[model samples]
Target: MTAHVVQRSTAETTLMRQFETEKLSSSPRRADAFGRFIAGGLPTRRVESWHYTDLRAAMRDAAPLAPAPDSGAIEDARAILTDRKRMAAWRIVLVDGRLVAELCDQFPPAVSFSREEPSPVDVDDPMVALNEAMSVEAYVLKVADGARVEGLIEITHISTAKDARSVYSRVAILLGIGASASLIESYLGAGPGVQRNSLAILTLAEGARAKHVVLVEDDAELHIESRLGQLAAGAELNDFVLISGGALTRRQLFHKLIGPEAKITLGGLTLLDGKRRSDTTLQVVHAAEAGTSREYYRAIVDDEAVGTFQGKVIVENAAQKTDGAMKSQAVLLSPRAQMNAKPELEILADDVVCGHGATVGSLDPEQLFYMMTRSLDRDEAESMLLEAFGEEAIRRIEDDVLAEALRRPFWAWLARERVARVGGEGEIHWVESAS
Candidate 1:
């Protein structure tokens, strides 16, 4: 199981010949998007949505530079964005990836924006041409027509140390007709050689509505890759993702409905222990006419960690009454931890109603001997039957302090992998069986 093949270095072609003339202002579409980010320079695993995260061999021993703006690393990224107490609404701060316009704030001039340049399907995506030749700044937010944004809209990606820093950060969200909102993208950190690269673009008009949340805790030797896009027309998108810490964590979500009754809801949660690694990739495109998509993913791999889920649903042919469903599930508790699920469905509408499902198991020894016959023990009956199968997928996140703050680091990584599998702190036997 080995993978790594990424090109275009010479310090990323001399940092794209110095941001190709400062991203050609007065746009010729930003000079053909800086010539399509100098012809793509960062996505590898030969693409297919980055086939299981391979940012050019994890930044090919990264060091293409971009991390020297320290004010004690912006006061340790403003004390981890003021200890995010379920932080809601208004925030757009970027440290290592630049953009801290005096701690960001000011945008409601009937919300309008620009600075979008880079396309040619992003020239075989080298992390979208290294975030379009090292993006210096961009935070376009528009929510005009029928706007209703009373709370929640945070975008904070702070970091300190953990070298190899390259942040081509961009966030352009446009929501108009019947507008509504909630956007949260937080990636925090605290030392230990980190690398962060991100890109986000969202647009929704006709009947627009949105709710997107992404949080990646840092410093388990951080390495993160993120890309997102959700377009509209009768729009309704609710995407959620959470990954605890990181050694190598990847997240990508792309959805294009285009118009007609569009609706999309994709959720994901990953908690990998020790030798950490988490990857979540999803793509859904109906492209007009009765569009509807729903995807659900859950993972919990213990020590020697590794979790990956690749989900796809594409229904073209003018998407006739499309209604798609995708589900990927996993629950592995060590035994050299690892979980991989791939769910796919691509149908050229035959009056479409697509389907996909995948499951990887472990931990249900009859619900831990019926919660150890009632009095719970065996690591509290396997953490109460793995928190009742992760509280049936975190009660489908209807937000309760953000689902108990994402289940408190997934129950402290299942009580430290149940004391590394009963080497101690074991006993709470409440034996009872049935069902």
Candidate 2:
């Protein structure tokens, strides 16, 4: 009998060594997760879900684990946080994957936070297992039952690693029955060679409502974020993600409607420039009757950048009268830019309505010419069209404040795009006016 040995990459080998030294690996759950990751290794193009990204090939080697945040690093993070544009929200700070108490703002009576140990999840992905094994701690936020929070609860993750390193963080948000809240998860800073893995879990009880916004604008070389959500009967959730930074990024979303009459809206906007690559993959399951979902995504690819979107809507056998629609669109600004989109629908119930569509094309030359004739320069006209293209997804947000806050980053990215189009010589700046 011949035995076949699985070949491990340098990054996998490094991860094994790091796991051995970590204190968290002593727990049985963590040990089991590490074993699972070792067995499967990193996902490759051969994996249907990861076919477009090829994470195993991209991660040639892994960096050392980031150290605990020291006083100097905390001060630097504080300065950065202070300089950023202020929004009306309650802030929680995490530096180098560790929560900083002094930097956080006081929460209202309806909201509470605590530190908890990472628990086992039902997800089958290797990356999720790795996060479970390597995460130092999990931050848990709970909204009291029937409480209506006034402002957003923002979790700001600041990476201050000046050298090549890896960081892992976990967050869980639970909303009680009849509770309503808004959340913002922002990723900022990190050296050019840093690698980060972040996980967020959301659970909503019956009659709960939530709005979630994720902003990825860090300088990490490799960034991967996984979001898991479960909704109960009569619950509603709206999730939006904006990707405009990082050299290589993959965002994964898994959501399930576990109870009848649940609703969900998933939207994303990706801005790809230079040689950056961004991939957004998602799966939504309608497991109960009369559930509703809408998935809309858009991307702008320029230079030699590449963008990928893969989404699937599943209607289970018991999910009668389920309604779902998914659409993905992209505009390529350069001849070398690339956009790949794959949308799928699986229906087991006869009374379900499910469909998906994808489209990729370049900007309209006639529109550009028309805008130019109206005294607008080429860059200005292009920016206007691109803004309108991306705004469609943003417009789905119901909250005016949250929608405007998310728009600031989009406007900033467009300003930078304009600068790159003309010449990459000047310092790009964008200021929000006091309207």
Candidate 3:
């Protein structure tokens, strides 16, 4: 009998070799993370957690890690700094996963920033493990107790490498008790055929309040983001993710309510076209008493696009009086477009209230006809309905400025449906007929 060998894929082989040479491979934490990654290789369709989108198949080739962005790339990124007044919030620029201090703006006095990486937190997610093992740069932002950050903090991640590359980045934000702040993460891709792994860990002290937004600028080959957070007593967290780019994207969030009376509200909006595939997965746990969480997502899939939303909420036995709701809605604009929504709730508490639901459909023909009766073009009518459908999630943003800034990307995507790019964020094809 001949000995049998299990052949690994090129991507897996490349990452395996890279793990052996990882800069932090000597560290026990990174070594463990790499061990976890190697044990699984990559998440495949067989993995229950990654059933909708098989990351292993999507990443067939392992692109070398991107280098620190060059000066020209940094300069080009700076040129994209527009509406200084609108996005005026402070800035932290990360060019190709490495921070460029000169490109960043001044942070609030109550805020302290450092490039030092925190001790890695153990996580089970494959994406988080990959980030821990391969990331080249990491930072931590601290907000002092009783302080209110005057300006929103914007962390800009720019991928300027024009070749096939992989960029790993990580960031952590810790808000002290009674501290309040708004933060934005802008993910900008400079070119095509790049794989990016990004991770963010947020911690909310007792009585702290935070609003965060993750905005993906444009299309990328593969973009995987994992966000983990914990909330203390009386803490509040409101988060939103806009997935308008990436040919294949998977965003996962895992949060736990460890303190009593905590609240978490999150909304996600995904706009996909062509052959794009985007998956948003969330898992929230209520471990204490009187916790409340609401999660809603809306996806607009066009052409041959595929969109998925997988959300689950769990209430522990100690979490009496817990309240949670999760709903996902999707509108498919093409017959070939596909959507998968799985909303789940696992409750161990008798007195807790939790429910989950999902809905999928195309635009209402009657509504479209009504708009057309009012002299609206068919395509324009369809676009109007799509915008209206997505606004439910956008309106959840309490800050108008932040909401407007977030809206621009959607309008730009709409314009792409019928016209070429103009100049400004507000310069959508208002007068142009989508037809």
Candidate 4:
């Protein structure tokens, strides 16, 4: 008795022939999340949490799904959302992945917006069951109960496909009980053979509070984002992610502090250069008792880029006095850059107090020779010590205008890394700053 087959690539056989010519795959929860993504197919490097971004060897094929926007792609996504500038105060657009109701904006009266249908996710992740089986529709966004909504609530996911395509999106964010909110999840225009699959679901409830900011500037040639969170009793959440575009990226976060004393603060920043590759994976679960968590991440790899940070902190057994902390830092600016950090901790009660840490080096050659002996050069002292090491994870955002709108794209990706190091090394260019 031998039988071991499972080979399937070509982007998992074009995602199983686009999930059998989708019509939301005849429902039943998108045919049981496309039969659990055809029994686990695209997540490689032997899937130990996708071992530093393998994604079926960087998705070898699959790009032809995005369609549904024309009226000249919604007037070119309404002229790029009316020439940008309005970082938030309620704005909700989404183009290639649907939800573009007259280009969105007008939510108050305790906030509300709907679209429904793609929920049910218990997460055994096969890219969240292939984005709940090729997405189709799910844009929720609710607030209500004890609402205090003030400024930010962005939610812009553009991607106006200009060539090879594939995009699937789903979003759901709800906060009720003693609700408070602030959120921005912007992933802009597609370029360079686009392919994106994104999913976001967050629920808060009891004494709810949330502040989330994620901006992955799209240069998609394969980008995957999955975030799921649930917090309840005394809920609070603060999450921040800023990855400067993709050429192959992976960002996944799963959080759950299900009840008593729930709190979380997770931060991230990854900005890699050419030959790009970025990955940030995190998981936190304190299931109950005195729960609290904090995870911070930072990375800045350069030419021949690659960056990854994997973090996990779990404390079950009735989460006794659980409190956790995790940190990851990286800097490598060349010599064929690369950074991989793994931080983990799993404690089963016994009055928990978890911890984790990781660091990868380079940049700080005696603080760049004391700022090049005080008159800086060498690319302005390595872009002022990599913008103070990516502004220490955007100063753990306690809203200084959302930490300067995530520091104007971390100072425009350090002014495009000093105009790609004074326009040399493989002649890179792109100098558009000022946010």
lDDT winner among the candidates?
2
Q: For candidate 2, report its TM-score.
A: 0.96
lDDT of each: 0.69, 0.88, 0.85, 0.84
Could you tell me the TM-score of candidate 1? 0.32
Shift of residue 9 alpha carbon in model 3, Å: 1.6
lDDT of 1: 0.69
**lDDT, residue 249, candidate 2:** 94
Clashing pairs in 2: none
State the lDDT of candidate 4 residue by residue for 100-174, as single tens digits: 888888888998988986356587888888887887777789899999999888988998878998899998898
TM-score of 3: 0.94
Superior by TM-score: candidate 1 or candidate 2: 2
Per-residue lDDT of candidate 2, residues 277-388 (tens digit): 9999999999999999999999999999999999999999999999999999999999999999999999999998888999999999999999999998777677778888
- A best-first ranking of the candidates according to their lDDT comes to 2, 3, 4, 1
Q: Can you give the lDDT of residue 102 in candidate 2? A: 95
Better of 3 and 4 by TM-score: 3
Per-residue error (Å), model 2, residue 197: 0.5
Query: How well is each residue in 119-144 modelled by candidate 3, as lDDT tens digits?
Result: 56656977798888898778998999
How are the candidates ranked when ordered by TM-score, highest leading?
2, 3, 4, 1
Please provide, for model 1 over 57-149, each residue's C-alpha lDDT reduced to its tens digit, 9 standing for 90 to 100.
655454445644667778777776766574654677777667776776665665544444323332234454455445666666778989887
Candidate achieving the largest TM-score: 2
